[model samples]
Target: MTQADDLADEERRLRQLRLVVDITAQILAEDRHLTLCEALRLIEAARTTAGRLFPGRQDTFDLVVRPRLERIVLERFGIVSTAPVN
Candidate 1:
């Protein structure tokens, strides 16, 4: 693939990541019945989806996205240790 093709593909993947993360955040914020365990599972699913969308970018996601998600979980569910996610 050409350089432009690679860039376009990366952009598309980034958009997908954003969509997944945004939707997950919405669920976490709006789902009043969501338990802490369920919220954590949703975050894990988002992380896994992110890893599939951008291989070898776990650290990037941890730095850029995980904290936000963690904060939301903390706020919604109260104090909980952040666990390693696959």
Candidate 2:
């Protein structure tokens, strides 16, 4: 890829990462009843579902957002995963 292509890819990934963080934050904020751990789990579940159903940049925001936030708890929050990362 050309330098411009590489930069574009980086920018796209960064944008998606921001969207993922934003969605996770919103999820954490809106559901006050759930504990932090529970909310994190919810995000995980959403990620899994998105991976299976959407897989990647399909079109809709739901498809794009979910996988970007995927597995963030394990990577970001250091959650002990019962299963290995695939």
Candidate 3:
């Protein structure tokens, strides 16, 4: 693939990741019926989807994306802590 093609593909993957994260956040925030276990499962599913989309970028997802979802989960559930959640 040419450089432009590679750039386009990366951009597409980025958009997919963003969509996944946004949807997960929306669910975690708005779904009052969601339990803690369900929220954790959603986060895990998002991580798996992100891994499939970005291959070897798990660390990037954990560092950048996971925290955002975690924060929403914490706020929605009315919990606060510095300890690792998962």
TM-score to native of every candidate shown? 0.87, 0.44, 0.90
- Stretches of candidate 2 exceeding 4 Å from the true structure: 42-86
Q: Which ten residues in a row have the lowest lDDT in candidate 2?
A: 66-75
Q: Model 3: what TM-score?
A: 0.90
Q: Give the C-alpha miss distance for residue 51 in model 1, angstroms.
A: 0.8
The full ranking of all candidates by TM-score, starting with the best, is 3, 1, 2
In the range 1-86, model 2's lDDT, one tens digit per residue, is 99999888778766665666587756655554756578657666556544444456434445555444544544555457686556
C-alpha lDDT values of all predictions = 0.90, 0.59, 0.92
Model 3 residue 15 lDDT score: 96
Better of 1 and 2 by TM-score: 1
